[model samples]
Every structure is written in structure tokens, then in C-alpha cells.
Target: MARPTLLFCGLLSFLLSCGERKHIAIWEYPEISPSPEVQDYFGTTVIDSYHNLTDLEDSLVQNWFKTQDSLAETYFLNNDLTTQFKNRFHELEGRTSGEVRMIRTDEKGNYYYLRYDEDKDTDVLFYREKGGNLETELFDPSSYTNEKQNISYLEPSYDGTKIAIGFDPQEEFTSTIAIYDVINKKFLKDKITHINPDFGEIEWLPDNSGVIYLYFPFVEKSDPKYKKHSFSVVYYLGDNPEKRTPIFGWDKTLEIASDYYPKVKIGSSLDSYIVGYAAKSGIFYDSFIAKITDVKLGKPNWKPFFKASDKIYYNQGEIREQYFIYRRATPNGNELCQVEIGNPNFNNPLILATGSRENPITQFEVTKDHIYFVREKFGVEISIFKIDNQVNITQLSPPFVPGYASFFGESVAHNNIGIGMDGWTSNYIRYCINDEGDFTNESILDSPQFQEFKDLVSKQIMIYSHDGVAVPLSLVYKKDMKLESNNEVFIYVYGAYGESMSPFFSPTYLDWVKQGGILAFPHVRGGGEKGEEWHTQGMKELKYNSWKDLIACTEALIYKGYTRKGLISLYTNSAGGITAGMAVNERPELYTSFIAEVPRMHPFGLESATTASSTSYIEYGTIKDSLECLGLIQMDPYINLKQNKYYPATLLMPSNSDDRIPLWDSGKYIAKLQKYNLAETPIIMDIDYKSGHENSSNYDAAMDVNARIFSFAKSNMRY
Candidate 1:
């Protein structure tokens, strides 16, 4: 008689023996209709078979998504892990107090911030006056409408008499501006719609009579140019929003492209001049300044302050007295500079503080007495420095170190600044820095202390890539946990737009370490970890460096005996899709599973006439040029998939209402993977019908998705 075969293998047994027989679930992928389409990119013919899946409006695509969602649900139900993870996640979340963000203090010492309300299950705007013990509920999204809404942005007038709040419906990009009278305790009748606050803030005039903001012409998502052709307009109190005057845009006298987004910047309420500029994705753009009086008269004479040829990145500089204090790009790094506002000279300016590659200046603020700036080293350690009128720099000794720090609030008038600091093992704290350089705890919210995270440890190590480049990799796990080949590792990646994976605390991440798992964060080339040079090495024609760096980091983990092959998982979202997707495609045996949320798997799709494509062409090359088209093809994950290849299990979470990345990118990529992969692993696409590119604001909805992700990772890594 033959020996009885085991249906499921134990974790210890599977880890001890490489030949252990583990039961792997072979999912029956849903059948998708193939609508073959071919495109010629400078004589290069690329054929796409699952082009029909891009049309989410099609009935066949809709049914296919439903079927995939059902299959994923059944898999999770059969494994019986989602509920366990959900309960554990909730327990971990309950251990912490609500979060507070966008904290602002007016000249009158009134504090305004958005705080998460446990009872309301959403963030609520709260206001507290000077020397007040009680906080007042200024605006509640729950009270506004039955549908879920969020306060995207808020700005208090210079006089602290009125507040401009941008209210955005959940899963939508457009926002409406509403003015609230702080003294009167009521909202104004004038309502401004079709406003895009993400591009800029609500800049108030010196007298606080109105606000200057970025405006969008189209309000309906069905419009072809819904988020395009944005212009800066001024809306006055008690005036019709339809009659708002356009100050700066491509249609105006300004020399800006149609795809360039225009924004207005008012340094201070006392300043007489305002700055205007047009940018594609970054701050390196041509900027101009004009007198507020001339702008109000609709006959402004715009003078060039900085041109795109200068390669200067805007940092919200201030206009003090007769001089404009700002930071400009230098060969070494960023340097502080000041020029006369009346007759600005870009060719030369007074340099105050200089930065080096090791400690580059990240943010700065101007005050009546001094200029304060923050610098970072290797994206981990932060230092706050102040420059005197004599160009002397002094580093302030804050209580927090080995963390991130940023300056906020109006420091020019009050001579007081708000500093936010947080680290990987520590929670976020707000401090008020006085003119005398004294740090005071100004946090209004309190967080609960959890014992489970007491033993958590984070280590920063540099791993050499295949090309001999040292990539910074961050590891987080229990301090007493033993490092071995059988350890389960989860690697998170997002290496685009020069965004850095800075240190920040998250209870959800801690929950993973609280269990016996290792969390890894690789500061790859495309990010701003090292500086602009690091980003340049991983973008456009050099895009392969990003994924190549990830592969090196993953292999280093296995070689270092921290983890083994088929025991690690890779996860990423949005533009980082290029990094994670390509890594898994190149070496599928390294990871047990892959998870992507709202991923940009198809880079060629960025050539379409969409807002995402227009702004992103600066980061990722466009298909219009032959050289750039070849680069886009090389980085396109969907186009690089191979048939008869063993691919790890993949779970793709995409929202139908995502305005940033189209659903087609995820749809087509997963459809082809499910059809071509030789492995029996599942390729699932879970669609969120009621959310956008930004994660869902609904607490339960976010928890549900996170639970599924963790559960899927756990189930796959068990073998």
C-alpha cells in the first residue's frame, strides 16, 4: 500500500525540508475577451491582446472583474485568514489615539488642525483660541452631507477673522471652497467650485477681502479635459464665482504651455508683490512676480524672477521688506539666497547658507529675526539650522533626532515656528520653537502606549547592487528575533518622482513586526535618498536601475541569511509599480507573492491625452520621441510579461474611480499575467467600486482592504 499523502504541511516541517510537499491552490482564472491592438512607436510594432479590458464600462470587462473578485473572496474564505487579520488589525488600531495633521497657528495665537474623531469616524477641523482650554468644532464633514466628504485643505486669513476650507467628496479630485467667519461663527454665502487645491493653497490678499486659487473649468468627470488647462483665478467676497477673474494661465499673456499648471503664491499678507509660476510635475519652472495692485487692476506687468533654464526648485520663499529670501539649486546641493524684490537678479544673489551633498537642505522658513531651515543626511537623521543676518548658521538642538522634521505656520510675523518630528519607532510630536530657540511641546492629542512595540528595532544598512551601487535598505523587526534563512520578509518599494521613504511611525507596520516577521524598505535609485543625482540615475533611460536595485536588495537579504527564496513578498503602489513589477518579472522565484495597489503597470498608457500623462511625462519619458518611446517600452511591466513563465501569486487592488492612474493599467496587466503564467499561483484583481487613487476615507473600508492584503501575504508565505 502507498503511503498516505498529506493535504497540508506544517510550517516547521516545510521550513526544515526543501522537498516538503505543500498544497498550492490552483485558481481557475476568469476568461477575458482579447481585442488585439497594435501601435507603431517609430517603426516598432507592439501588439496588445487584452486591450478590451481597458474599457471598464464594457459589460464583458465588468463581468470579468466580478468573477475575479468572487474568486478572491472564496480563496480568502477558504483559507480563513482575513477575519483573523482584520480582528488583529482592529485591536492594534484601537491601541492608539486619533491622528492630528495640517496644524496651523494664526498670528492671534489661534490654533487650527484636522483631528481624527473616533466617534465620527472621519477627520474634523477644530479651532482653539489663545489661552483657551477647550477646543471648538469648526467644521464636520459628517454634518455637511450624508455622503463621505473630507476637508482637503484649509487656510486662515491674515487677520484670523475668516477661514477658507476646501471640501472634497470622497474618491473625487475636485474640491469646493467655503469661507467661514471665525468671529461670526457662520459660513459665508459665496461658494467657489471647480477648485484644485492639490496644486496650490488658498492665498488671501493683504486685506483678506478675497482669495487667489487654482481653478478647473470642467466639473464633470465625463469631460475629456476634466483636470486639464488649470488656471489661477481670484474670487472676491460676495462676488459670483462665475465672474471670477483669471490672473495667470496659458490663455493669458503668460508664456506657459497648455499642459503646464499655473499656481499663485502670496508670501505674506503684508507683501505687495505676488509670485506666479507654471509647473508640469516639479517646482523647476519659470516664475514671475507682479505688484498686487497691478494684478487686481487686470493689467499686471509680470517680471521674471526665475526661469526654468536656471533649474531652481521653488521652496515657498518669503518676501520681507524689499528682499525675497529663497533657496536655489547649487552644484553641491541647495543654497540659501536673497535678492532685491524690486529689481531681482537671477544671475547673482547674496548667498546666506550653503548645503552639501551629505547634509542637504530640505525645507526652510523666514522669520523677522532669522531664517530657519531643516537638513537631512541619508534620509534618516535631521537637523534644524538657523541663519543670522550676518550669514552665520547655527544648528538648533531639538529633543528629537534620527527622525524627520519640517517647518510650518506663519513665522515671519510672530517669530515663532511649528516643528513636526517623528521617527520609525516613535510617534509624531509637534513643537513650538520660539525666537530664542526654545522648544516647547505643543501637541494637543495624546496617544496610547503599546507594550507590543517596546521590543521593535530598526536598522539601516547599505547593500551593494549588481552595478556596485550601495543601496540603503531599512530593516524593522523584533529586537530579540533570530535572523535565519527561514524568516519571513516583506519588502516595500516606491522609487519614483524623487520621493524618499522617510522615517515615520505606523501601527499597522508595527503589527507585522509584533508578529515574527521582518519589514524591509529599500531606498532605491529613483528616490531622493541621496539627492537629485540619485533620482536621475533611475529615471527615463536609466529606469532599469530602480528595479535592478530592488533585485539586488532582495538577493542581499537571502545571502545575508535574513530570509530565503520563496519566503519573501514584494509590495508597492502607484508609480512604484515599475520597481516591484519589473523585479518580480525578472526573478519570480525570489518572492512568494506580490501585491500592488493602484499600480501604474503600463507606462505606454501615459502617452494618452489625460491629466496623469501630461504631468507624469516629466518623470517618465513620453512615446512621442523614438528614444523616449524605447525607454517607456523597456519600463512597461505589462509589455514585458513572458509566456510559460513561473510567476508568484499576485493581488492587484485598483479603484474604478481612480482619477490619477486609469484602471486599464491594472486590468490589462493582470489579465495577461493570468493567461500567460505557467505556475498555478492565483492572479487576482480586487476592484474598489467606491474609492479613488487616494485610499478610501471610510475606516471600515480601509481596514477590510488591509486585512485582505496581510492575509494573502500570510497565506502565501506559509509554504
Candidate 2:
């Protein structure tokens, strides 16, 4: 059963009887006045025609969206090809799920996890005790609110009596944090509201008295400008839960040029430790150590732990014994360092693990006897290693696995570590390391039959970019498939925020490959695949390199006879959406179909918007800067499209509830693109009202979205 608009059952019936694409009428777009807004940016005159569309609440824009939805509904419902693709994707998705594995284990031997119940068609949170036979259902998000609301973050207390869970209403940026009592399976009266949707890092005190969390006062102040600053607050969770005392923030008396509140993290063992980075930049940080024996006794004397300079960026660390094992960013890669708890001099900190271009520590975790870390090589493969205080490194995991592994959630005591891992040909699986040092793994959900992929082959290959850089591409396809230009291919890229799109398994991608299509993942610049140097090469003024790298990957695939022009489709979301939008705008001829989910389209328009966050300015510099302005204009997909040019069959998927990048961003971009495109190819804006930047883990919701996307892809292809 599905919504009337989705027409799930009707489409299934149509799919079973269909043989060819049906003639569906494509409605003409609603007429809107060409209200151009001109502005002078550093002596450059920029013209914006869809300025009126930016007002998402405007009657005109709302009416336009309704009309577009009506058109899409009619076109998709009537087209037999749409039904066919939906059925195929639905079947494939039914056999697999994006199961949320229990990422953390508490000292009390409790393992908290989330999984989709196929019978219920929703995701449910469950926790099992160390020796318990039955798994207890902690939270069923669907029961709390509508299907759209899901548990975005869950952190259990050290003692396991309480747990902090963040509930995110789909499409909205803010989340509601509530404390839950484990034994009773009930929520406490205390609720912490207005958390930053992107960053909800919270640390519970060892005493279980309160939590240390980052809070932006935008909701309380109700001022748009207030969003620029976020401070750390200690909220005691007893009878007086209302008392939220600020721990670290704006000391106006201190004559410092930086923002008063930067992103900070707190941890405690023998003492409390905090690592803070200037919010203005994601790079460097300052550390403080305090004896937080009593969280309710106001504040304690904070001693200097390590004063971070511009050169070193603190990732994460913890205080164990008298030494601190922390990870810091180096020139080439991130390294693990050991320092005294209250070390006044930071220069003499001992290097526990020296990181380099060849062996970069992507992530690390602290244990009593040993420090466990993941080192990545060749930008795709990762291996786990552990080192003791004796400076001896031992390989815990095999040198190579099919996919990469990373920290899944908060770790529990007893040396138990949970990891989330997947590969191009692999399904998402959860692995656990027991106290005895044995690695155990289980599929997150009932994965699709792996036997189907026995004929498939996946590997990583290098392709030279425009600037002679060897960009890596991860590809998966049927081994017996002919390497001909006729083969259909799907390419994905996201090269921003130094966040790499790893070679992970996807049922959607596997469905395409199973249908004789090829899936290629371009490990382009702008991502941390090759470390910070690769990221810096494609950021700010050099942002074009990201899309350029994607284009180069496309060309190389075509040249190698994996696919031909007009046979390949590209997909990306968020920052990756920026990469996809830019690539399609620059080289429309290289692709037949393009899908951008919640894309960062016009940087100038985005920066000028009232809803834009000040913290985002660091990624793509402010508009006031001349070079940044020029780069934003050059990369603006809406502005760069040529009039009367034939673009690819484009799908712009934006979540109506997504506050991160407002729906209007995609709305305005689609409107401008539709006006400029004279070709018969479709430019569709598929808006999901129930999803957000982080899609739901619900099984049905996943099926619905995949059906829509895969159906569109199927309709655009030539048989």
C-alpha cells in the first residue's frame, strides 16, 4: 500500500502487462513573469532571472510546484516504461535493505542497533544485553511521529542506565534530543531542543548527571545572524533539567579575531578533556583539560592540554591513564600523537603513529591496552591496525577486504569495537571485535542473493585528468558483459568537504549492473580519498578540478569501450550534487541522463539567501571576496547553462523538508534550466516531502524513491 500520488499498486499491475514505452503527454510548464534581479558584485554585474522563484513561500512558486507535480504524476503514471523500471527496482530493493547496524556497545554489554522490519515496513531500534537472549526494542521512530521522523543519532551513557537519542523530522534541519531510561524503555522529561542538524555530537558525563552538547542559539534568539555562532553547554539532567550552563563560548573581553565559539568536543576518564577548533575553519583546534568530578558544581579549573596552531588540526582523542592518544591532521595525512594530560608545551608530544601519503590514519580509537586505527592506501582499500604503548604495530584486519571499514558508532567497554563496512560488489555488513580479539561479522539486513553477483567483477583503475593527475575510478559490472560502446553505464561523484564517496555496496547500483549496466565511482579530487592535499587541490578557487576529474573519468570510460556518449548517466547528492550539476553544465554531451539530489546550485544566490548558514562560507568563500565571487559565478549551474542548448534528461530531486539546502535552491535552478533548454529531453523536478538530506532507513521509503529514480533512468535509455 502506498499514497495515491505514488500509485504503487497500479504501477505494479501496469508493469506486469507492459511491453513498450507508452505515449504520455508532457504538460507545458506554468507561465511565470521574467523578473530579473541585477546586482553588482565586486564590479561584476550579475543578472538573475529566477529571483522571484527564490521566495519558496510565494504563491506563484507554490502554484508552479503544484502544476509541475501534476505533470510528473500524469507522465509517470501513464508511461509503461515507468512501471517497468519501478517494478524492477522494487523487486531488487525488496531483496535488500539499508539496515542501520548497532554501531555502539556499552560497558554493561549492551549493543544498540537499528534495523528495518520487513513485516512492519519501518526501521526499529533494538538493544541486546551482553548475555541476553532477547533483543529489546528501544525506539520505534515510526511510532513516535510520522514515517518521516527517524532517529538520526543515538549515544548510550557510559553506565548504560541512560541513552541520548536525537529525533530528526524529515526535511527539517533541527533535531529534538531526548534522554531515554534503558530499564523502563521510557523517555525522560528532559528534552534538549534546537540542535544543529548537521552536528549533534553529545557526550554524557560519567556520573550520568548531564550531557555536554553544542547548541546554536538561533531558535532562542530568533535572529538569522545568530546562526553564525555555536557554543558548548552543560545541561544537568536531574530535577532541575532546565538549567543549561554555558561552558565554552564568547568571551567578548578577550581580544581575539576568531569567532567566540568554535566546534568543540569533550571526553572524560580520569579527568575531563575538550578539543575545540575555530568554527570559522574546520582545520585547527585548541585543547583544555579539567577535573569534572562533579558536573553540577558549576565549572572547574581547565588546564592547558595542547594549544593547537594553524598547522595541526585535532580530529578526535581520549584521556587514558596519564597519556592522551589523539589524531591530528598532518601536511600529508592525519597522524596519531601521544601527549601528557596537562602538557603545557605541545611541541614535545610524542608521535605514536607517523602518517604519510602512503599510510594515512583515516580514523583511530583508544583502548586500554592498545590503540586501534584504520590506515587507507591507494585511496580505496583500508586495513585496521593496533599499536601498544611499546610502539609495536600489529595488523588486526587482513591487508585487503572487498570494501573499506570505518568507525560505525560510539564504542563500548571491554575492547569491543563495531565497524560499518561495504564494497562495490559487497552488501553493508557490521563487524565486531570481541575482548579476545576475534572479529565477527553479520549482514545488517537480509542481503540480496550474492550468487547473482558471482558473474560480476569490480576493481579500481586510474585515469589521467585534464591536469595530468591520476584520478582513481572504482567500477563494477558483469565479467561476461561485452566491453562495447553500446553498454549502459551509471557514474557517481561527490568531491567536496574532503568527504570521500567510498566504494560501498548499493542495491540500486547492483540492480543496474544486474541488468547489463556498468557502475563507475570516480574518486575525484576535493574528497579526502588521497588525503588533505587532494582535497585542497579541488577546493575554493580550484573547485573546478572536482568536476573536471569526473569529466575525465567519463571520457576514459568511453575511450575504454565500457560505455559511449549518450549511454552514460551521472548521479550525485549534496556536495556531490554540486559536482554533478557542474559537470553536466560543462559537458552535457558526455551524459544522457543526470540526477542531482538536493544540489548546491548557485553559490552567489545561496550566499545571498537569508536562510544560508555563516559556517558554510568557509567551504565556498564569501561573495565579498573577488576570486571567490568569480569562481562561484563560473560554477553556478543555473547561470552557466547556454540558451537553446540541449542538456541531458535531468532529474532534480529536492526534499521539501530539507532545511540544509532549501528546496528553493533546486526550484530556482530547475526553472532557469527548463527555460534555457530547447531540446525535447525532459527536465523533471521530483520533490519528496517526507525525506531530507539524510534519507530515512525505512524499507518502504527506500523502495518508493528507488522506484522513482530507476524508472526515470529506464525511461531515458534506448533499448
Candidate 3:
């Protein structure tokens, strides 16, 4: 064993406060004074007391936050049960199927890629010489002075002389971009700060003189017009950062064209055309394009790129010369459409490729010579193909693993197409496809040790919901494990944003499975698993479908004798937090415990959200609308929570610095739960001071969070 084994037998109750097990006392919650605030949505009056918690900058709220975090740290971290969980996690952390993500090569053929290194405790950037097999450590984010800071992105310049890296403190949404000299292996003094780490991206100029990126202002509260908006600027290396020229934003005319502000992105081609996306509603958007030369000259005659249509919620594409290859949302699936650059309207658009709801184009990449695309069938099997300039489609041959791949265009040799894959039950592989359609994978890193997982069984099952909708479920457990009502089970869900949960090997999850716990992933509606219609059915007014689907799945599991109510726990984060939180509140008896990390407790309470922008309103709908308010009232976990309820033992993980979802959402949620719950069920709030929704950047800190969560689930999930 890599770690000392602690006695875990009979200590489960001590770790998690299981029902009827009074071994652990319920600690008193921190005293929070209610500041009632009311709002009138048409005729309905909504009252809020813990609303003040949303004011993160308020002196009283800050003090309360500090006190609550301090109390949580002492209550959750400094304990024997946590130590045991950490040791157990360390035991399983080594059992991994390593992955390589975003493999790229510079003009000099120097290869660069990010590798998930368990031993290093953080993802490290590795560099390989043109033809060398030996990989050199280019950047290890874990070596930062502030242990919580981690590298978020890496963008190598055209000439490969400089690699622009963006890093941020863990869980937070702010990033700082620093230029690194690839030859010198050192970072430059120039740094670009106030970047919206999640959505912001950097692109180097063709000449390699500078880069174009976006940044938000450093203010306590953003201007309403500029809320969650980033201004694009061109930063020249070794030049004064403050002197960077702003190329985007300050456009009052463009704001009228779309409800949301547009962000700038440099196209993949050498044409140096700047693309802008202004999302009007949902996933559908209107885009604009302008040349780099015009923007540099301070004129920037922006022209309409993709015009939005009411029927299409998603219209995006890559600009290839005078033609634009677009993917538009269709009734059955996303279909590819093309239009000439100087077209007056999309009245005469040509359909290039068509797909159904089951076999949709998940992603597409445009290279100089070909357009590569990945088509997913039923969210399980994936197929890749390429289309040449003459519209000749060619499907690559066998050894096609079911996983995700990223294409990095053609290499310097132009004879091969650079590709990287994240496979199921396998390590990430980076290779190239030659003109002969043969894959030549270069060994850049060693495969992860997964010998222990050979005995585990992975299966896909379908459970019928209350409405008879067959929701897809993925289950993984030891082959010898028996299906029983007393078995501990964890259900993970993310029922929003059309995001599909792919089956990938995770040491943390494998550890749980190794310990006889069953892991389940329910591909419920609101995810892209079944396409846009599936997502639409579980969002906005129909949002209750997400939670209802979760409940139905849970009940189905219990009915099937997989696990009893008191033996099952649920885990959800980000938007899924809203789904899981609401589901548990609606059916508290169905779960033993719950973990909601960086949750959006109150979608209607946008005032409390960190990045409450116009874009979010499109997803959750505006609170000012009576119809939306009614739906929000029915689905918002914070609003639906009642006093004197015997809620399941719940752990709320919130970071103090998360700018995407905001920590205040969790603060106010913990306040309400503590004030309402009268049962001994622990409503523990584990607050990370430096982390946010994404959790800690430091591997140790992140592991601690996982240990606490896994331990709580293991302990509380006992009958």
C-alpha cells in the first residue's frame, strides 16, 4: 500500500451521519441574521432573507463567510475519517489510464501536449524535439509559488519561439497569460491579467509579433452592459501591457444586433480573420467577421457572418477562404450548411452533410485541405471522417477506438494529419494519419497502470422514467459484486447545457468501485446524449424534467433491487448541482446523502451569481417574466426548500473566488439549509478559500476535497 491503512470498519457512521445513527452529534450552524428582501414578479411576491449572503463584498457577509469557512474547515477536514479517505484515495490514485489532450506541433516540428501525470499531482506540459523520443518537461504548473495556481491553457506562437500560457488559481475564473520563451524555457515579464479563464482564449498573430486575447475589468461589480463581457486586445510581447490596443468592444451598434455581447476569436486559417459570436438565445447565435488588418488600422468594418434564424438555435462554422462551412441546428439533428462569403442572406444555403438525432456531428475541424468531423451514434460509438476540397468524403479504416479525438490540422510535413484521442479503458494516444490512411502514433508518454481494473465490469443500461422516457445509464462495478439493497451506490448527473458525460477511466471512481461501491451515470434529458431536443426538453420551463428524470432513475434502481434509498448517494456539480439539489429536495427519502459542488442554488437569483450575464438569462430565462418566475419557483432548489424538512445529509462545497457561478450561491444555500433542516442530518458546508466551482488547482488540495466527498458518501450511505 502506498499509504498507511486506517481501520475503516465501524467508522462509517462516524464519517457520515447515517440516519438513526446518533454516533455523531449535529454541530450548531453559524448564526446568520436574516435580511429580508422581497420582489414582485408580476403579481407574485417573492421574499428572501439569506439574500444578503449574495453580497460577497459586504462587511457583514464577508465576516459571515470567513466564520462559516473556518467552521467548515475545522468540522470537515481535521478528522480521522478524512485521513482514512485520503489514504484510500492515494491507494487508488495510481490506478489510472493516462490521457493526452491537445497535442500540437510548432513550425519547427517541436511537439507539445498536456499529459495527466498522477505522480506529479497536476497536468504537465511536455515538449519533444522534432524527431526525438525523449519528452522534456516544458511546464509543470504544480511548481507555482502559490500551490493553488494551475496552468489553464497553452498557445504556442506561429514560429514556436514563444508559448503563451494562461494560468489561474484553482476553482477561480480569473486567469493571467504569460509568454514563455520556448528556447530559453523561461516566462517573460509581460503578463496579461483579468482574463475570464473559462471562456477567454488567446491567438497569436501570423507574424508572431504579438497575440490577441480578451480581458475583463477589475471591478467589484461589472457594468450592466459589460457584465460577463471581455474586451479583446492585441498584446505585443515585451511591450507595455497597458499600452495594448483594444480591438473589440465599445460597439454600441453591435449590442443592438444581438442581446449578448460578442467575443473575438482568431480563425484557424492564415487569413487572419477575426470571428465574433453574439449569442442571441439558447445555443443559437449571430456572428460577425472582420479582417485583422482592418482591426489593426482602427477601422474594423465588421460584416455579418452567420445570421440567426428562429428555427435554428445553433449556427456556427469555420471560415474556409471565400466559403463558410456551417453547422445549423435542425429538427432531427445538427446539419452542415454552406454559404458564400459575399452572400446577401442564407436564403440559398447549400446542405453539405446531414445527420439524425442519433448520429449527429458532434464536432468538426477545418484544415487547409480537408474538413475533419466526428460523428457520434447514440452517445456511445464515435466515427471520424474527412472531406476534401472536391467534397470527396473518406472514412478512416479500423482500430477505431470509441473515444474523443482532437485534430491539430496538418503537420509541417503536410503528409500527415495530427490527432489525439481520449479512449475508454485506455491511455491517450497521439498519432498522425498518413496519405495512405494509416495511423502512426508517436510514443510521447507511457500508458497508465490499469491492471487492477481488469476485474471491473462496465455495462450500459436503460431505465424507463416516470413518463416512459428511456434514459440511458452507464454502470461500473466489480464483476463479483452482488446486486443488493444494502450496497452503497453513487449516482452522478449533469442534466444541463447539452453536455454529454463520456465514459472515461478515473482513478477516484475506480477506487470507489474497487471498494464495492457501484457507480452510475444517468444520461438523462437536458444533455446532448440525445441531441438538442433532449436538451430543450429539460431546460427553462421544462427544466423540472431533469430532476424528475433523476428521481425516476433513482426509483428505477431501487425497484430493480440495485440499492435501497438509504444506501444511495448523489453527486453533482456546476449546473448539475441545480438538478441534483432540486431532486433531493423534492424526494429527500430517495437519497442517503448528497454532494453539491459550486452549485447554482437559485437560478432566479442572478444578482448573487458571479457571472450573471445576459447570456445566462437565455438559458434559465429572465426572472422578470411571470412565466419564467413560475417555472423557477417550481424548480429552483433554494426557493423550493422548506423548513422542518428531514433533508438528506448533504455536503455543500463552495469556493470563495469562483467567478463563473459565484461562491455566494452556495453561501446563501447553506444559510437556508442550516436554517430549515431540523433533523440530525448534517448540512455540512466545506468551503475552499482559494478554490471555486472547478475545485482546487493544487492536486493535494483537490485530492483533499475528493477524499472528503468520497468519505462522506461512504459513511452516510449505510442503512
Rank by lDDT, highest first.
1, 3, 2
List model 3 lDDT by residue over 248-358, tens digit each.
664566763322545676554355577776644367666778887887666787887665662333424666667767676665867666777667346667776667887
Per-residue C-alpha lDDT of model 1 across residues 1-719, encoded as one tens digit per residue: 01112222221111212322234554567777788888888888887778887767788787777666666655655555678788888887766536676677676678888888888788898898865768898888788878867777788988888998877555567768889888877889878887767666788987889988888776566667767788888878998767788888847567677667788888677788988888777547789888999888776777777887765666547888899888776546577788898778767888887777656776688877789987777677788988877778888989868567777765456676778888788777778887667788775656567777989988889999989989999899999888788788888899987677888887777787888889999989888777667777888889999999999999999998999988898899999999999998899899999999889898876564343425777787877778878888888899899999999989998777777788788888998999889987778877776667866445666777888887778777744
Q: Point to the candidate with the largest TM-score.
A: 1
Candidate 3 global lDDT: 0.70
TM-score of 3: 0.88
- In angstroms, the error of model 2 at 539 is 0.5
Q: Which of candidates 2 and 3 is the stronger one according to lDDT?
A: 3
Better of 1 and 3 by TM-score: 1
Question: TM-score, each model?
Answer: 0.93, 0.90, 0.88
lDDT of 2 by residue, 1-719 (tens): 12225222221122212445322324256567768899988888888888888777787788776555555565566666656666766676666554555356666656777776766655688887765657778888777755446567788887788888877544445678889898899889988876763564777766677887777666422356545556667888865655677665544332223333444554432345454444444444455555665334656454445554623555667667666677776766777787776553456678878667645777887765667888776567778777766888877764237457876433313455566667777666666665445567533334456677768878888899999998889898998889898898888788887776677776667878888889889988888777777777877778889999999999999899988887888888887776788898888889888887777777668877666654455666678789988877776777777887888888877776665677767877788888888666778777776766666535555665666666666566643
| Best-matching candidate per lDDT | 1
Model 2: runs farther than 4 Å from truth? Answer: 1-27, 96-102, 139-150, 220-223, 226-228, 250-263, 268-271, 277-296, 300-314, 344-348, 408-414, 434-437, 442-448
* Candidate 1 total steric clashes: 0
Answer with 2 or 3, whichever has the higher TM-score: 2
Model 1 lDDT-worst window of ten:
8-17
How far off is residue 539 in model 1, in Å? 1.2
| Clashing residue pairs for model 3 | 171-692, 284-313
